[model samples]
Target: MASFTTPDGVTLAYDDIAPAGEAERTVLLLHGFASNRSEGWRRTGWYGAFERRRMRVIGLDQRGHGESAKLYDPADYTREKLAGDALALMDHLGVRRCDLFGYSMGTRTALQAAILAPDRFSNLILGGVGGRLLEPSTDRGSIMADAMLAEDPATITHPFLRSFRQFADEQGEDRRALAAFVQAQNPPLDEAAMAALPMPVLVVAGQRDEGAGDPEDLARVFPLGKGVSLPGCDHFSAIPHGLTKATVFDFLDGLLDDPFEGRF
Candidate 1:
């Protein structure tokens, strides 16, 4: 376990998992909203898998989540700021470049990081997200904020909102702080930004994930992107699903062999 202070002075917690032998590559894993690195990667068996493949793993607890400093101000959770924290973590460890993996809300941060520092990342693996990244949609953030702020989860009629509230309660998250974080979410990345990504990209999502929109559609926007589906899985279930791991690893293996090969 280690910690680093962001430029804004918030201390973020992270874990660096080394390979058993010499490392072939490095990967940075980012978790979703109200989730930490442990539950996101370590608990899902990602750390072990990466280590087995001789890949160094770096996982971080984004601000207001896990062991990181929690702030109630919405201003503290901007997309750019969150992305900056990831880059800062890399700089702290003297990592020049790495493969980036992000899920759900973390995917937005990953995309922003790639956009801001295009040369710092070699490949991008985005899970639990899809075409929603290309256009604006309903304010799910506000709905989630309201859900987290609700006095009673059962009182929230919206099914998704209720589910999020229950999940947050289970995680023992600071509801107020998470609410602020949700409210601070920036707008989705535009078409131009998505098209500008020059590195090989993989977009994966559950077959039944309505929240993710359409993975295939999202992949088409990227010049060097491909989409994979996790059969018989939903948004939450897809994260730890075996199919997700297989698809991601296969995509990563292809990148390792030939980074320029765009087709999967």
Candidate 2:
């Protein structure tokens, strides 16, 4: 449990879990929307997995979530700002390079981070998001923002978006801050932009994940990318699955004979 105040006065929270000796490999974890570092990774079994593997873990609570400062203004949640926080945290911790892992909203931020600081990441593992990253940004952010700001959750008409409100409630997160994060516009990027990333990327999503599109489509864009699907899982359920762990570890360990093949 540690904290750092951003240049803008936003206090972000984070935890650096590492081996007793100096760390050889580091993984920076970015959680999905409405999820804090602990719930997204530690309690979800990632911390233990990394511990056993002897990899250092840097888990950050991005602005508007967890113990971090909550700002109500949408202007404060730009993609660059979100990505900057990740970079800034790394700078704060004196981490030169790491394997980056992000989920859902965190994946969007990860893309921004990779684009901005292409050399800081050695490998990227994006979960809970897929081909949807290539799609144009639409009004869904506004709709989701409205859902988070809704006085009554029942009024949110979109079924899937409504579930976000419910999940936020369960997590006891700040709806106003989350609404701002949802409303913040992402940078203009497409498949060509994704194609430009040079690091090894693994895009993993649940087979039944309707929230994200085809993971294979997303993976094929990168020169060194691969995609894998966790059978019979959805966006949230895939997080703690054994298959998810295997796919990620195998990729990180370079154990797969054909790295380009999109499955285990």
Model 2: runs farther than 4 Å from truth?
Answer: 257-264
lDDT tens digits, residue span 135-235, model 1 = 76577788888889988777999886787788778888888999999888576676688788899889999989988978878989889888876668899
Question: Over the full model, what C-alpha lDDT does candidate 2 score relative to the true structure?
Answer: 0.88
TM-score of 1: 0.94
Q: List the RMSD of every prediction in angstroms.
A: 3.4, 2.2
lDDT of 2 by residue, 32-64 (tens): 999999899998999999988889999999999
Top candidate (lDDT): 2
State every prediction's TM-score relative to the real structure. 0.94, 0.94
- The positional error of residue 234 in candidate 2, measured at the CA in angstroms, is 0.4
Clashes of 1: 0
Q: Compute the lDDT of residue 247 as modeled in candidate 1.
A: 80
Clashes in predicted model 2: 0
**Cα lDDT for residue 254, candidate 1:** 78
> Model 1 misses residue 50 by how many Å?
0.8
